[model samples]
Target: MTDEHPQVAALLARSHRLGADPRNTNYAGGNTSAKAAVPDPVTGDDVELMWVKGSGGDLGTLTTGGLAALRVDRLRALRARYPGVEREDEMVEAFDHCLHGRGWLPGGEGTAPSIDTAMHGLLDAAHVDHLHPDSGIALACAADGERLTAECFGDTVAWVPWRRPGFQLGLDIAAVKDANPRAIGCVLGGHGITAWGDTAEECERNSLHIIRTAEAFLAERGKAEPFGPVRPGYEPLHEDARRERAAALAPVLRGLASTDHPQVGHFTDTEPVLDFLARTEHPRLAALGTSCPDHFLRTKVRPLVLDLPPDTPYGETVARLRELHEAYRADYRAYYERHAGPGSPAMRGADPAVVLVPGVGMFSYGRAKQTARVAGEFYLNAVNVMRGAEAVSSYAPIEEPEKFRIEYWELEEAKLRRMPAPKPLATRVALVTGGGSGIGRAIAHRLAAEGACVVVADRDAESAATVAGELGGPDTAVPVTVDVTSEEQVDAALRESVLAFGGVDLVVNNAGISLSKPLLETTAEDWDRQHSIMARGSFLTSRAAARVLTAQGMGGDIVYIASKNGVVAGPDNIAYGAAKADQSHQVRLLAAELGAHGIRVNGINPDGVVRGSGIFAGGWGAQRAAVYGVEEEKLGEFYAGRTLLKREVLPEHVANAVFALTGGDLTHTTGAHLPVDAGVAAAFLR
Candidate 1:
């Protein structure tokens, strides 16, 4: 109980505070550490240990369990045993032996140490922080970075030349510290900042001082308009025009970004991004690529920038983007071949993670929504760095060979291999109409569980939002309000879905209304409303989604929740029955037409879902009961008794059929209808 406990807590607190602001560090881009003395469990003597942020952890959300603890003496002693930079990767595996009896946590279990562990353990300080702050990287990437470092902090901070991160780089920093006794930290050229102190508070202060001083240096001496003046043809569009343009281009860009694998998408048109894209030097700087490993790893070596003017014809603009996409993929493949060694990991993917559209915004893609969003953020950081460096001096990142090495490093491959397998629908995005309640809600929940990002669309905004929240908030689900009867609202809802999740890969047309009335009693408005909400609604949603799906060239699915009444003759059900029948027919027509484009269209026929149904609760139950001469409360039982299986259909049962129609195994079974009514013989598609 000496100062060890408090020191560990202090490390976490310091890490959190530093990481809270994006200006301090990008997501999961840095590490922090502390050295402490604690009593050894086996022996009565005090043992010195170094606790550092473990691999794959984000400092802002770090916990005690996310730390790796190792014996400081043992970590430093490896310097003598280190073969050289040639075999630095082997040292990572050796870290296991240095662990302090499995780990230093309560159960002696902790996260594995990251590659940056050496920098913390080898430093002769009680506390250390390494961060990828944009300001620091701005100076680090400057062509005259060493001179700028000296000018920015004088003797307070030292400069170290670019070197791949590993055990050797740690020793190099220690050497710089030994030479400059008054230096508080050192800037790792072409990388980020590393600072240390005798205490946690002092270490935090040193890190901030280095970051702020670099920021101030550039502000004072940097030239105006670092990216050069805004290009004449690339001015940002008006706000409404901008988002409209982004929505139009996102799916195409998303498709291009998914050349390697399916990816979710994120869009950002912040002032900084729009400003950068409007500048003349953006293309030049972008081609040079990002400096820090963290930036390029997430954003790719460089982004795919749209070269044409924003006001170009729509067809022309799309053609140019597709051309650029092909060139980017070719370039990426060539880059992989140029530097790949026998032992290097295989090229991960040829897709560009970030796409830059002049006047519109930036679009980034990843295997998940959060990952895509973070990639966009990291590119923003890169933009800031490029501006800062270009203002004071030329921006020059590490050579291409070095970037290739890091991107395909064997150790990084090992880390990726350790990740858990993805769920069935991991990279897919789904849009479910009427998803606020009943069967639609169940479909949203089921889709999210399979790892797809879900968009809940309903005329009721509140219910849609509530259902989306239940499905795990914005990360996994988003809500959009739409009245399917209005074409404009339907189009807007589809656009919102694209914005929320890059593009739609699955569409569920489930919104409907019911009226239990004889043909003579049914009014014209009733027929129109039912048709508008079911047949027409499905058509509008499917048509909009078809545009995106064809643009993506990726296979997709469309599911129609038709009713048994669509095929079975029923009493006093003329309007609702005709509308349902229309929907069932539309599904077949679309499946046949879109089959060439790899879009599967199918329908689900269910008996009256009396329980947990919005339609049933909205007076449909009592009306149906009266028509059948049964009590409203016993409607479900009556329906169940008529089915061969005698099982009442539930919302979840309908959801299961949707998944079955779209899930991987049903690839060849399109244009077919699946009955989820517990065996309604009359409704069977013969």
Candidate 2:
């Protein structure tokens, strides 16, 4: 964090690690832009909006693709949209529409907007944050809301009532703007706070400092904040206390966890109660979250507080709680009776909140319990501020129940709907091996035509440079003289490629050597040579590409130029077929590993893309004439008659297939061997 503002792109990725584990590992909550992408206010771009942490996403796992972009105007309009949406029936429709509607995603050029987009937009500050800090929420609930905010934040921050955090929240902010006019920043007592800076760096600096200060406050206030013997890993949340609850909750929690891989376990150290209690099976968090304004809608606010003392019977505790839980239910009915009307904030689900087992500690369960705690933490922090502010004056939210009705209603689910965004390949760098004169060159040209910076990697510098020169220069297409099999050359090519451009997104491992000789006719040297380029070389390039792609997390695609022979036997093609088959096999295994990291690996098998390839001009001319007993000139037409399409295949066709496989519409596809041949193998077999 610094005073110097960051670039429009800099905020997309940073080393900002604040949400470290209780032991030592550092995990982030989300990414933000405290520094504006646009430099000048008057002349600055209107594209500015505080891109904040999404409701669901791990900061450690965050990728450029995950950042949601919201425009300033679109955010302002959200305030206006909810006022008119009154009924849950009508409100839900609008909410879904808002989700479908392009609200403004800066980096999310083509992505589903975060569900909390409205919450972040409502903050008047230049940048806004919402994170689940284990330590932060521990303070949000210090008995008194406003006092805690002050105890931790002092007088610089303002405190607002927690009023279901979306459209209603924005309306509240706008109203506050209408009244106080100069209020710098405020926190939703049961949610989080918003702080602004004139610049992105200033914003991040302020946010980080504020968080650290809050941590310091907790240390001083808790009277138990000693680091002496307790560190993140060393000071484990009592595992024995949570054993049964953890065991019982595991099966039921998968729905809430969502991902195939959900972090579960009770180790000696860490946020023990939080780790287990957050995934409580009961609907307490959900009810709190869904009925009124709380983390219920997103995470459901019911916490399964399980700190059972050694003597208390588990059966008796559950029975008594069930019978007396009517207080929470009564509060809901009364709340609904008092404020709800056809147009007022409506309830969507049932839940229990504020669970307090004698030993387990306090918890607020919601759809995502971790999220619930974060919201509660934000609220608890502001509660302190409110207590201080209220001491001088009364504290209320930027009240607008009608707006809250829309944000918490069923309609908002539309914003959560997603069908993957467009690929980064839309406008970025693409490297294709053997691109000088074959399918590689064809793919390079096709990608360039599709608005990408293309790198044509080949052994022949003359042809590579010539092809590159014809297409354009470094900006469009550039030829790279690389011996793909050499690790030094591969690394050099990758480094030079990134240096030439800011980064690389697509790697087309389309280089290969083909020897069209029978198995007995193929020499060991020929086989080794073919495998070197077709298999080992491709892997080397892919390894380098994976490092870059994984770091960016937006993803990159690797397209291997294998042959249809890779999939099926091709007569008199022993060396080529063997090498290509190895390439195809590796593509499948690597896809699973790379996909989770945001990179994609797939292949294209073009049986005979000789039209615009080097093979057409060189090796094949002598061979085809001898094999067919016809002049070389007739070979192209003779080959055309032998396939399903019965039309000769072009290099561009194969290249187009590569582009599609790497692009978005087919985001779910991987481990695919798309055949670009005119069905020649099928024709020959039949």
How close is every model to the real structure, measured as TM-score? 0.98, 0.40
Best by TM-score: 1
Candidate 1 on 552-657: residue-level lDDT in tens?
Answer: 8887999999988989999999999999999999989999999999999999998999999999999899999999999999999999999999999999999998
- Candidate 1 lDDT for residue 208: 96
In the order shown, what is each candidate's alpha-carbon RMSD? 1.7, 14.9
lDDT for model 2, please: 0.54
Off by over 4 Å in 2: 1-143, 153-156, 166-184, 194-408, 416-513, 517-521, 528-572, 577-605, 611-675, 679-682
Off by over 4 Å in 1: 1-4, 106-109
Query: Candidate 2, 506: how far from true, in Å?
Result: 18
